[model samples]
Target: MIYFYNLLLLILCYLSEINSARILGIIPTPSISHQIVYRPIWKELSQRGHKVTVLTTDPINDSSLKNLTEIDLSFSYDLYNNKHNFSDKIDKLAGKPLEMVNAIITMNADICDEQLKHPKVKRLINDPNEHFDVILVEILQPCMFAFAHRFKAASIGVVSMDAQSAAYDSVVNPTHPILNPDFMLPLAGKLSFFERVFSVVISNVMRVYEFLFIIPINDKVIRENFGDDYPSCKDFIQYLDMLFVNVHPILSGIRPNVPAVVNIGAGLHIQSPKSLPEDLKSFLDNAPSDVIYFSLGSNVKSKDIIPSTRQIITETFAELPYTILWKFEADSLPNQPKNVKIMKWLPQQDVLRHPKIKLFITQAGHQSIEEAIFSHVPMVVMPFFADQEGNAKRIVLKDIAVKVDHKELTKESFKSSILEVMENKKYRENVKKLAELLQDEPMTGLEKAVWWTEHVIRHKGAKHYRSAAIEMPFYEYFLLDVIGFLLLVLFIVIYVSVKMSKLVFKVIFKLCGGEKPKFKRH
Candidate 1:
């Protein structure tokens, strides 16, 4: 048995070494968790004898992998932008994904427009020797699909965020009929008649400007250096053929049925048998038997947690038998509960999988949900924005968890919700059941993603599934006029029938009156 196992391993490694993959870029946002996700797949690719280039501001920080190229994109992902008080302009779009989408489209157009003109970015674009077999683009919103498209390689887009629009495009969570059901084109769910028309107008305006103005300018710049005849990445969709979403369908069950959009999220278990950080392990050693893992995620700071709400959380735990392990950056809580434990950073997956972890209190981000479900732990979700609300509602609807509002949210509401999940037995059972569903995934999400990514490469770019938005007319694609024509015919037939019936009735009335008036057409 041992000899056969060794032989099989050797054959696998030999096969992998021969398959060299050249990845164009991984544009990761500076979030640590999001970065951790990309790390596994990137490392997997490199292990499988692939060359991976990550284009971002995140430096070569971790010493985990080789065959890597890091492009220092001199840019700030700062969301605050020198504002004194945190702005609500962006936050309000949290659960309302379509609003965030419009913002993304506009922002992407602006950023790309600016970056394409920069000397550094321009130089890279002009380089004739920088060709690659595949360009794996991280979908930096407002649509960076064009970025990979520009590189003249087969393009694949990856989303590493739990934001609604991104998750909606990637995962397929079973919706609760009461709270959430099947929605239409937009991530904000189905739009009204007027809203649909408005979306159409907005989409067209942005697209026309992008194609006519933006694409032409970028194309002209490329032509100035690359060659008048060479095609830009924007026009290379048929060439750029596949996409991989870093979402486990168990957590987010949406699967794009299209052949080109391969979602192999079953690979999340590749990093299984979770381990705890040394420091966090020490903290847990000292804490009580019952510990609830509380975190708002990296983007949203817990110290920024409103004091009024914090008091409610503190009081809620005051009555509970279990202690609270909160992830906060601040040194101290004003009125700390005796059972509460605060930490700057957490070994999240490690802790969630811990035997002592009774309940999870989270922002309900997609990745967080994935970790919790994989760990078979229930949660009390306190979502801030984006798809957080939708995620929160999904779990709550599943009878696996509860959600607390960030706006006008009270401590009493927070306390009661937490108590219910902590004390109630059903929440745990439902969560465990959901966990099993997530667990029984076809394969580990990471392996699925890496395998399919290389498969797309091995097959010379899976071109069959690309939507020809650039080629097909909007009307024909959506079939708007087909339905309109049918309705028009129906209306004309109805009108003709009504007119003939009225004529017949008038003739009958004339006959009953025993008199006929001669009428002539002039």
Candidate 2:
């Protein structure tokens, strides 16, 4: 009986192994904000019995997740920090669409080079035995997508924010350039004619740059790492089985998405409120109902603000009745107000969940905005760069927040924006209403992401979900060939009709015995 029981146990273990898959996630971006949004995905997949190996810059080193393996690529941060100073350029490249695109494309190429050459990545590549059943790659880094093809796995694109126009087009989704501008552009709302023109120009320029510059760099990287026989980087788009974009109808306006695209942007990184630190809890507990939570998110540091703007912020905070919790990176802030509490880092979601909190002053990152909405807190959004400007526009349009332009920031403007969000009852109501809609989804973002990921794993690939539009030629997809044929037919009919009219006139004139008096050679 004991021998029979042991044999049954072994058989059960074998069945489980056959059912589970090996997933490789390449979230190689250096930003903490980007990594945090995807953390839940691998963790949940591991919990569900799949073996997950992630090449990541930020690894949640949890011993409990026995099935998860993390290959740390934290060195990418050194390259990122040495190359780009986001703080110094808040007033410069933040508003310039072309310059920003150039900067990001250059940085992605640089990071991709170092990432592919890293020792651990090379080991994974050279090991003939290594295989992944699925590859979840960050779509922003096109070079990373090569891993999907390298492993011969079903590829899925993932983004921490809304998908770029180029990525949308790659999957054959409509861009609606004027109605929904690309994430790189700062212009939002009903655009002026020039803004509309600028959007179209900038959007196309990015796609052209990706084709001419970015893809070549990616192709070169693939050859150096994978092999010379590796397929072209542009060809990888067709193998994309699904895209898990961090967007929702409430965040971005209602837009069409292909069947394979799933939105997991509804606070995927948000967690249940944890116990706040002692000092922090004391601060919030004793504060008034108008307490303010201020953070610029992880990528942008509060201590890095220019001196003049810092002074304006300090003075404005001093004048406000509400206590402020600021995520100041530095250990000490000179002349910090008594009512203001400064911490290098704070539990942002927990702080927002506090009952005493009234308003959030933020740089309007997508993740931060999602948290504010989840907590039903209105905002005073001072957008600095990237998608912040667009997010600020979205919330302001929804009437849940007031936008304070970073360039036009003043003590009075800052104070009034804060007061407006706190003093007005409608902002809170609008936020609550929007939050309800966001929360009304049938499954949470994590569930949707994990379910679809497993779905792709179960089926081996999702080629069926791929849009037929992706395979269509440009002329055929747009019906330009059909249009050209119709135009040609119309031209021939008009030409023949003109010739026939002239012939009829000649016959009539000849029958009437009219002489050829037409030639008056002047």
* Candidate-wise lDDT, in order: 0.63, 0.87
- Model 1 lDDT tens row, 459-506: 767655555542556586567889889899999999999999999989
TM-score of 2: 0.95
What is candidate 2's lDDT per residue for 149-189, written digit by digit as tens?
Answer: 87899999999998888788878888888988997677678
Total residue pair clashes for candidate 2: 0
Model 1 residue 316 lDDT? 77
Name the runs in model 1 displaced over 4 angstroms: 1-18, 57-64, 72-126, 161-240, 248-256, 266-270, 274-279, 467-471, 491-522
Provide the TM-score for each candidate, comma-separated.
0.75, 0.95
